[model samples]
Target: MKKLFIMLLTAFVFAVVNPTKSEAKVMYDGAEVVKGQTGKMTFKKDIKVYKKNPNGSFDSLVVKRNNFFKTYDIEKYDGKTFYQMGQYRVQATDLVVFKEVPIEIRSSFYNDPIYININRDNGMGSYGYYFLRYQLTFLDNGYVDHCFSDGDEGTDCDRYLGTDFKITERIEREYGMRYEISKNAEGKGVPLKESKTEKIMEKGSIVFAKGLEINGYLNVGIEGNDQEYFWVPVNLLKPVGDK
Candidate 1:
């Protein structure tokens, strides 16, 4: 009995000390968009759509066949390749016809500017600066502030300008191709290029203004500090008052 008790205690201790690592869940494949690539696909037959749960399992629902859906990226799950829709995944075997659609830039900034509220927190709603013909660079977190020092004291300083406001027009100047400034041997400021791309705005965040569409990206103006515009996926942004 004592030997058995010892073995159980050792197992418990080991399990507590080095728990089994949970499987990593990937939401997107981070695939680069090639020129003229299309995301529109038609379902071959009625298929079950799978959405990954937070606990590493999947919940499925039936989607009618012959329906069309656009996928942004590819995903690998359970050794199977799946196309990623907004929140749903369909297996590659279910798709039959692929269609090419011309990229469209639909903006209402001139008639009526759309305002949005970023629903993400904890560094998720952060944005970057897009340098034309150069690269998009992520800014440091310290440079961003949700509330400005205008003698307003509230959770988000909504009283200052309110959470919903129209994004101002874009400033017609180029953001130099550098993430930060560095001093050279002569004490002159040098621009250092950053290779890290910024994270996409979380779903449910608001898009205030949209400018141009190129290669699945939209030049958007969002609500935040640092008076400038940024580029994000056209599908990721939703107008204000949308569920």
Candidate 2:
């Protein structure tokens, strides 16, 4: 009876220690994209999709370039990027990164032309030379009658949106529309023309939606306008919440 018990114990220990390679579970490091961030995917060649199981070895599907999809929730495995698309984990390459647009100046200010007269006596007799300089005007439009300058006051000053307005959220995932500013950069609320705008929003397109804390602003494609971009308030944007 003692010999039989010993043999049974040895068999149990060997079975537990010597599991098959296929039965061994593989562990992966955990990583994910920042919550609520949007990402675009592009691939140079066809890629295989895998299940997010412990082994992560089973092939579930194949995704070609023509039908590549975007990934909202991303993870990293073995130095490759993976997204939780559909029911399985899809590996993605050639990932395009979207950076947050930063706001530079909060309060609105405009450029004003200033002329200075300098009398320099460089041994060639004193003569006045006129030079131009720009100064920042910090007062709100309604408060001041006109722009103040050394030689001129009550002159028209270019108005910019006050800094009180902010972008509460961004609309990422959804297609963004392309536009052209109706007027020059100084024209904040210029009306948009339907003819010059692209109906569909492309990747990296800038859009300021309405229904925000303040009205959103956007310029899809400005026709003949020298300005690359203009700030507009958008209040009507609903972006995915912070993940």
Candidate 3:
């Protein structure tokens, strides 16, 4: 087996907005809400974009109905009408993409900074990842990428200050099959703040069996013990079977 430096890049979650103009409420934590952003939403397609309108209203962004990586514009609303704009939570039970990434055995604890030891059960530092300033941004076609664009504005590298962490273990949706995450709570990995002592990795498999929780929107990365170079989002290791 080839050894890979797993980066565990952070998943970019775009804000979903509710499309309704009248009263609205959020049903989920908004962490994985799709079709609507957290806290509130607006079906008010008529509302102009926030700062683009010459009239100073919510100037609706114009969106190309394509997923082309380039030629996508998201920062400004050109002219795409929203269907919804509030939190639409996706529980672990609701996980549908079981095979897009590795199955981390820990909680994300998103939206805050945390401290963890990456030392795996067998002394492998597979879980010790770190991040600099990793903010989220959406493209015109809805593909969210880690901030820090492909090019520089000028001499500035646009280097934004970010956070760092060390964890004992990590758990994430299994990548590859892109199909199912176990609906059985007993089989499905636990969520944030939950700790377990059972060893999760097999004898020969390279795994991060510990748990680490970081608060609020983190930029994920993993560093090897050699500290040569860190990687983001381990490219190999997709889901094997079910959750």
Candidate 4:
């Protein structure tokens, strides 16, 4: 009987280890878009996203894209498994709401911007730079599927339904984050555009979602020394089109 119990314990351990197979959870937000191979997109190049204070200063420091995707002609680069579209992609709690979270700030170098900060972090919501930090949680929901593109939040900072409109929780804690924000380097804030397709992605076609959080579009500002504020969003797009 003791031996049988040990065998059952081993099975339990294995079952727990493979929880993704049993968890009845969606993996991404529905509004997010993806191009390229569609599977787990790769983040080969080192990228950075940031949060700006009302005073026009960067108040957040969120992500640093891994370099594997950049060196090779990899299709996906999201720091996880990469596969083809319609294969392993999923729709989970994507889209970010202007909610509150903790944060810290630092002076922006190069005299171009202002400050940067540490926003929220979670495996769900947004991935690397896909989180919303403290001080700025007033806008409505924005797409978060395309880790390298913008979200659906509109500009002007109006609060509305969060990205996960499906979430019925009375008080959810969704946030946004970004990575690498330096001028001497290739910043990843170039307002991403739609480039997905039932057709294949072109060799040089800029792949991304029309979400407002993409580079150059995220409405942020500089507030007090490292103070936080809700960033503005514009729209959500399909990686292939303006869905």
Each model's lDDT comes to: 0.39, 0.34, 0.23, 0.26
Predicted candidate 1 versus true structure: per-residue lDDT over 174-237, tens digit per residue: 2222111111111101111111334444445444543344333455544553454555544444
* Deviation from native of the Cα of residue 140 in model 4, angstroms: 11
Model 2 weakest lDDT span, ten residues long: 101-110
Which prediction has the highest lDDT against the true structure? 1
Per TM-score, the best of the predicted structures is 1
| Alpha carbon deviation, residue 84, candidate 1 (Å) | 1.9
Measured against the true structure, the TM-scores of the candidates, in listed sequence, are 0.28, 0.22, 0.18, 0.16
Candidate 2 C-alpha lDDT tens digits along 88-168? 655544532322111122111113222111112122212111112223333534211113444545455433222111212
lDDT of 3 by residue, 17-69 (tens): 43336533312323232221112222212222222345654434432222111
TM value for model 2: 0.22
Rank candidates by lDDT, best first. Answer: 1, 2, 4, 3
Candidate 4: tens digits of C-alpha lDDT, residues 12-82: 99888876554232222222221211112223333333444668776433323431111101122233221
- Candidate 1: C-alpha RMSD to true structure equals 20.8
State the weakest 10-residue window (summed lDDT) of model 3: 67-76
TM-score of 3: 0.18
Looking at candidate 2, what is the lDDT of residue 24?
A: 28
